[model samples]
Target: MHLLEVRGLGIRNPETGTEWILKDVGFEVGEGEFVTIMGPSGSGKTTLLHLCAGLESPSEGSVFLAGKDLAAMKDRDRTLLRRKWIGFVFQFFHLLPDLTVRENLELPLRLQGEDPAVHEGRIEEILDALELGDLRDRQPHGLSGGEMQRASIARALAGRPPLVLADEPTGNLASRAGEETMRLFREVHRRFGTSILLVTHNPRDAAFGDRVLFLFDGRLDPAHALEGPDLDAASVFARLEELGI
Candidate 1:
């Protein structure tokens, strides 16, 4: 079964007249795969990512993770499922301002019921992988934009969740840092065998994915997918140009 499945998902702006923020969106992410969704602002990229992550419930259809429908699970069960199965990384490193980097990582681990002292466990592995050992004690404000982003990514992956949902993971950083962050994501997928669904407007970010999907004005077209060994930044840019994205 796919690690994550979004089926005919749709959400409406309750304040408006039948306006759909996301209209019948659907997709799947398989185990150990990296998929990127690219779209312009207001194209429903983050909204779709949130729906898949269970951060929001769709007004239409359902989302399934590990074969269980998100809309069907009980509140507690869904909470537990999300804590253990899904990881989230946002554009603005949503780290708690007062918490140290280590504490930020620890908070989720604790919530997930994983002992931080499990030696050679996910926390340790991720810390080493993200090179955050020395910055672990620093508060969020003390770190560079890149460092804070790395810490946020580390927090997302520290529990070794099967699926990581990222919304504009590189959107707030300088170009070099953004590139580094994207590379880190690629490496994390390779080293941990985790599935990823990332949404972004940057072609460079989309190029790192095993496959790419384009979203246009809250609508997704499967025919717009770009995938292959030739899926590089240049190809992604060309496709974006062709689509006038």
Candidate 2:
């Protein structure tokens, strides 16, 4: 079964009944697939990511995560589903300022009511794998941008969720740091076989995915979806230029 699916998805402002952020969008992500979405600013990329994460409900269609209808589920149920199946990495680290690296990485498990003692090995594994072990006792303010983003990625994967959603994860980092972050993501995907759906404007970041999709004016431009040999940083950049994005 598909790990994620969206059918005829649309989002409209309920109050104004005029503003629509998305319309007639449909797609499916299979198990262990990595997909990247590229779009210009104000094209609803973040909104689409939120919908996929079950944080927002669609006005006219359905979103299915792991074969269950997210739009039809209650808020409580959706929250549970998100905890169980989704891991999120945002543009900003969003780590609690007061928490140490280890503490930040442990937050997701603690939120899910999982015992830290039982999952301690997993936490350590993530820290070591992400090369954040040396900074484990340090708080976010003490770390570099790359280190913080790495910690954020590690925290997101600590749960071993089937799917990970990243929104502009490299946005806050420098070029070299951004490249390292994308490399880390690729390595994680290889090692864990986790599916990733990321939204970014950077062609280099988008090239890490198995397929590249373009979004324009709240809709996915089906004609420009590129994969295999056709999907690369150069091609993505070229396409972006062509689209005036």
Candidate 3:
């Protein structure tokens, strides 16, 4: 089943007036598949994720999430759809400084008017699974970068959304921390069968995905999809360099 479908998508910055940030981009993500989008910085990788999540409308073409046309929905309806089916983990942890880790994790459910009694057990399970129980009372500002990133991911998963859009999820972490986060992502996929679209410039990160997509000038090069021994770090980096990343 196709969870996401983007056809001939194009996005342009009205301010630049010169070029399309994303042009003629198209792809489909199957149910429960982990897909990595790789490109150089400023190559519209993040822009594509934003479009997938309906945070921004494409300048042309269509974005369909779970068979629904995102472009045809009003802003309020789009937001509600995203809340019910999509989760996002951004490069920079966007936790609120004033809220404790537990509060931050609970905010999404609160906004959706989910009953606290029904989710309390699930919340505890997630905290324990993410190793965040001890830091539940801590504020985001007090935690290390890795911890903050983990908490951000925990919050995204709190609602158990079917599709996850992660933007450079390990960008701020050290090598070990990054690998740990990737393991967590894999665990989430195995346990929940959630589909993920992860955007990253780092080839090392591509190893986590079932399919790696090379995005150059906002277009996917399907010929470069990685598998088995072909997914070595050297090969991945070489491809990124070829794309001028």
Candidate 4:
């Protein structure tokens, strides 16, 4: 079974058009798989991510995480499921400015009712693995763009959840930092076998994934999907050019 399945997803609302325009999107991410959804800005990528995370209700179709329909679950149950099963990395590096890096990593565990005493050591392991050990006490405002992103990654991996959804994780970084971030993501998946579904418009970034799916104007054309054991940036860009994405 797929770890994450999005079938025929669409947005709905009589007044707002964000829901009115997107329709019939579908895809799946297998366990231990790394997949990239490549689309230009305003392609409904964020909306799709939100739906998959159960942060929004779909107007049509459904989103399934590990065989459970997110929209079918009660609000509290869905919240608990998300807290325990999904890790999120966003473009903005949503770390709390007031909290230290270590504290930010611990927040998700605490929210899930995990005892800090037990998870603290695990968080340390994550910090060390992600090379954030010395910077763990620094607040978000004190860190560089790269450092903040590293800490965000550390926090996302704190619980070692099975599935991670990253939206333009390297979007705000410089070329060198962005490369480092992508390599870090690849290493994390290699070492931990975490299923990752990342969305980005950059071909270089999208090429890091085992498979690449193209999204244009909020729609996925399965015919344009690229699959390979070693897909490269050149090929990804070629596909994008052909599709005019």
lDDT of 2 by residue, 1-245 (tens): 99999889999966888888888888878999999998877888899989998887788888999999987788999999999999999999899999998998888999999877798888888887788989999999999899999999999998889999999999999999999999999888988898999999788899889998888888886677778976789989998888877
Clashes of each: 0, 0, 0, 0
The residue pairs found clashing in candidate 3 are none
lDDT of 1 by residue, 51-139 (tens): 88777888998899999999988888988999889999999989999999988998887887767777346677898889898998999
What are the RMSDs of all candidates, in order? 1.3, 1.3, 1.7, 1.5
Candidate 4 Cα errors over 4 Å, as ranges: 13-19
What TM-score does model 3 achieve against the real structure? 0.93
**Cα lDDT of all candidates, in order?**
0.90, 0.89, 0.87, 0.88
* lDDT value for model 2: 0.89
Give the true-structure RMSD of model 3: 1.7
**C-alpha RMSD in Å of predicted model 4 compared with the true structure:** 1.5
Error of 2 at 11 (Å): 0.8
lDDT score at residue 62, model 4, on the 0-100 scale: 92
Superposition error at 138 for model 4 (Å): 1.3
